[model samples]
Target: MEWGPTGAAAVPADYAVVVDVLSFTTTLSVALERGIEVFPFRWRDARAAEHAMRHGATLAVGRFEAMSRGDARHVSLSPASLSEVEGIQRLVLPSPNGSTIAFALADSGAQVVGACLRNAGAVARWLAPRVADGASVVVVPAGERWHDDTLRPAVEDLWGAGAVLDALLDALGGEDEVTSPEARMAVAAWRAARLPDDLLRCAGGVELTDVGFVADVEIAAQHDVSEVVPVLVGESFRDATEVQPAAPKLRRVDG
Candidate 1:
């Protein structure tokens, strides 16, 4: 899995998975757990805010730089804040990487899923069945950009992808069973697992921890904490376990 530069580019897989562990995706998961109705705004903040107010939702805004006002009362999807909320109606989120990639993949022929370190293992288990069915999966890490420079392209997502790949490999076995180049790429990326700590200390991970979302950081870093895999349908995330697990190979591993 890799994070690609944003724009209206073609999505490269039969199934596309987006990872924004630092905030956007994490916040989306947190909001859903809190019973907030999440409506993805794509890249339009003004439109998202308008929709929230129109729906009688108390708007909570989040951005790439810092936590927004009212954000403290809600679960911050980003690494900078871990505040929890009971229920949120709408979340106005803007991330340096997540939102852009998500929106791009939204209309891709591929099935899009929201992934994070928190749900890595579950995701792997879930994908097993799909792979068995001949589905191609692409894991996209939302990459970090600093002052026009994209630094550490696959650090965070690679770790998460590696965990998922390891699980899939353990379950499915052998290169012949794997068909997606993205999946193969993910396995290659995991080669860095030999120095797991250094990989975690990369740019995106450091920023996430510095922002006080260390729990999220640690949770995402850990392999396979939950057997629950979250999938994006329309605009809402649903637990994959609620449905039958895909029948590919099931490999168990710690993230």
Candidate 2:
């Protein structure tokens, strides 16, 4: 299934991929690759700190705050910032769209993973074996916010989700076994929008560039550059590669 941030509750798949290309999931992919456990939060608030403490995680500050430090050790939502840092045991990553959608999905009992253009192929390959034959895999794009606080579907996110969908479909052989129309369209859109150059010209990319986050946009646009698949487990995201394989479910004997 494919939907914007607002349709998070509508996801019905047991395995889910959340794509937020502008920053959230992209930063998360970078952070996870560095061995830091990321705890997603819906907002940067008092509750965010509380949630972080409960999970033994440190609350990430705003980008400005993170950038001001001489050593730049803080973890913020910026993918560029997270890419250079290391040795953080836990971090609370807050985002209005991506983290909110992730929080919602966590409550719905799906095994959630963050995906971006950087790691779509790796995530697809990682998830393919876990998906039961014929089971659905939902892809939720964390779009930007409109003036009225509604979801404004973002081109970058669409491409990011598409990259993951395209890889997963290829992994599964074809879309013949899948059911979502949005998923098909997402893959087509991704195919139409080539990486790097196309992404740099997109609306989201333009916005980021204007705001002086050109590096973040550049980093987010890199396709299949990362192999780390960040899976949400318990209260934080750990490297899916390090997670122990799930034990097979045993059938109960009939009385």
Across 1-255, the per-residue lDDT of candidate 1 in tens digits comes to 555544214435666777766556665555544445555555546776686666565444443433545445543345334335544555555454776677666666556666666566667676777777766666777766668666446566666666566666667765663445776776776665644365447776576567655565554555444444556555545565444423323232233
For each of the candidates, give the backbone clash count.
Answer: 12, 0
For each candidate in turn, the TM-score is 0.74, 0.91
lDDT digits (tens) for residues 23-103 of candidate 2? 999989888888888899899999998998898887888877886874566778889988787667789999998888887
Judge candidate 1 at residue 209 and give its lDDT: 64
Point out where model 1 deviates above 4 Å: 5-11, 33-37, 54-58, 63-75, 79-83, 89-92, 149-152, 177-182, 194-200, 211-216, 241-255
Worst 10 residues of 1 by lDDT: 245-254
Candidate lDDT scores, in order, read: 0.58, 0.82
Specify the highest-lDDT model's number.
2
Task: Give the worst 10-residue stretch by lDDT in candidate 2.
Answer: 246-255
